[model samples]
Target: MGKWNAKGLELAQKLEGVTDEKAIKKLATETMQEIIDACPGEGSIKRPRAALRKAIESVYPSLNAEDNYPQGYYRTSEGKGKGERYEHLALWYLTTNIDRWSVEGDEGRQQYWGNLPTLEKTEPKPQQTKQQKPKQKETVMSQLNLDLDTETQQALDFALKQSGLEEKEFISRAIAYYAKSIANRHEVDFATIPTEKLLNDSSLAKLPGRAEELTRRAVRAISIYNDDIAPENSERWAITQSAIARLTGGRAKSIQKALEDYQGMIADHHAKYELNNYSNRKSGGRTIEDTINIAEL
Candidate 1:
């Protein structure tokens, strides 16, 4: 591929779109689904790994691609021949290099810059003239350090009390949402999506009772997300309700958020999981029902 020009950065920024703070926050969410949709499957013409390699090469064509995967690449064949060798290599490469973006600081959450490991800094040169002042040493700090002034803290506390959402709740949910947004952007496996079932159904439902329940719920949730049925409609609602219950272990507040997030994902994935139902026609899409029996589970 040719060099990744300003055009690529421009396209990525365009993909981000123009917006104010609130609008940007919402767009931050939609970007996650876009990343997920780009996930590779049986006939991946452009695997995420390959696409990333191309992007990196475009920027630094002289860089050795093999050096990027020193452990050698995995074959995409099935059974004993298939493994996660290359996938893991690609993950480490990206984690150590690209795949970074910044988020704007919110009320309780702050964003940080990410990059590959850096070499030690060299000492500053001595001033040539005595009149020149010595360079001040820099102090690095973690973002978690509280930067709020007393008045700002007081106002925030009062607002939380008035809103009936304790500071803990606000902070916890904000962190969860922000973290999920990042995961979505990076196309990291949503621990929420079950992959074990897709590989092998076997007697997954016959494991030890507790294990069986966990496996069953995961299989069902994966089914719902990958299915072609209308995920936002009534039929899918049952699955969403069950998924929330499973994820939150029956906590009311947890259930509320889980349900909201699950529905949000369904809406975000509408193009894949069509919302329309046509009983007479057979669909190439997977059925959300067969994968998950929420009421029975």
Candidate 2:
């Protein structure tokens, strides 16, 4: 692109605040026509210069007048290395409008050959090393409990379907396994009624687990105790006490008693057990230190 010349600069400076594109184009066209008219001959460099000036003026109104060469033209491959094609004309047309650039910065300004960088290429960063997770020990029950990823779960479902167990039986066993898993969450050993007991024992057939039996008892105890002691007190707290009673055999109820009474005792018993479990767990085996020492002796 050829740099904007004296005539183009002067025209651009003339129309600084004229924002309308059509108006600017019109002004540019008229100014170029005037410059051409002023020039002596039709095919003179003066005519092309005037046209170039007009285009620059139209596009870049706020061009720096102090600079000697604010814009320039270069040759294009089209038109057999032409003098100045329509594309060059369009460049002049677009570049002339300084308003096309940002208001605060020189982002729209074209980089010139003088400012081209000669810096070396930067090397890429090394890839990060990912640490492998430690391998977990697998037991039969552990494998059974291993979170069969969703894919494995589907496979297990299919495998279970192929097994001779009925769908209902499968569900029962699954539920029992699930309950056992929950019961094992804190400690490896805690006195707990077996799933077989729940299924076979008439008294416990309806009970899900010790905790559940406790919960039922707690709820029932709270309901009853609230009536006997204070109707407005905490039912949930009473229920918790009932759980403790059931586990310790300290509550004044038999399993043969009303459902509410039995449920209360179970609740009281479980609550106390849970509290002790929590304390023992937090002490990091210190809670049982004396017992361990005695056993060792």
Candidate 3:
């Protein structure tokens, strides 16, 4: 399309910024008529100069330019070869204000190339590219030293192997499991109720594992308290106590009450486990669980 001569260059210059296909076609038709008029003889079929043809081709990328697509002759072949023949003039038609055009045959074809020339401005738009942050490298791998007793160490190892995970991953998962089970997220007290209540309640019955879920949450809270409230644990600091009191609406007695409630839950579980069993099959021990006084225990 770049073989433009002096005349073609002049035509291109005349059609500059004229992106509308209709406008370009009108200009092209006017140019062709002028060329025909300039020919020495009236009936002479003059081949257009390379410059003129290049100018048109540059403007229109399609096979034939004029009116719209399929405006020129259709070359119908009987058998082999390159399929069809075109006897009409083919030229480029600009569809966008940008460097884009459609090939047209005459004023007859309806199909277009690239984007259809709209009345609205069709300039290619710039995009907003996001800037990404560079990732930071890990500096230190913080470690925890658990001085586990023989039984606990054995259990940890057994659990690590059983869960098919690395020691650190196993510990992390274990902590997450217990931590996530807490009822402290909402005010619902799972520790105070039995599974039967949730199971029997018509409203809760349809909720699968509602009782177990609540029970797990309650158990998690107890476990957290048992582990963290010890003097050695980081959570047992004076600041933590003050924070807890402040979180409980600055009620001085609330923390005490909560502690007593949590203690009661642990005692209840221990008492139940010790006394309520039908039998300890491994130990060959029998239980008179009903007769055991919880207060005495």
TM-score of each: 0.22, 0.18, 0.21
Per-residue lDDT, model 1, residue 222, is 47
lDDT by residue (85-170, candidate 1, tens digit) is: 22211212232111221223321211222222222233443445212321210111122455778998677555544544333454
Q: After superposition on all CA atoms, what RMSD does each candidate show versus the true structure?
A: 20.1, 36.3, 38.4
Which 10-residue window of candidate 3 scores lowest in summed lDDT? Answer: 129-138
* Candidate 2 lDDT by residue in tens digits, 27-141: 4544443333343333453446655645563554332333343323222223364342222222333321222211211222233222333222233223331111112223332
Candidate with maximal TM-score:
1
- lDDT, candidates in the order shown: 0.36, 0.37, 0.38
Superior candidate under lDDT, 2 versus 3: 3
Clashes of each: 1, 33, 16
What are the per-residue Cα lDDT tens digits for candidate 3 across 1-297? 332255666776766666555566655544543443344322331344444766655654333223243432333222365344332232432111111122344333434332343222233323321111111101111245566689987776555445544344556667775665453243454445554453245444323344334333334433444344434332221112122222222222333334443556555644543421122111222111222211122
- Candidate closer to the true structure by TM-score (higher is better), 1 or 3: 1
Rank the models by TM-score, top first.
1, 3, 2
Off by over 4 Å in 2: 1-4, 45-297
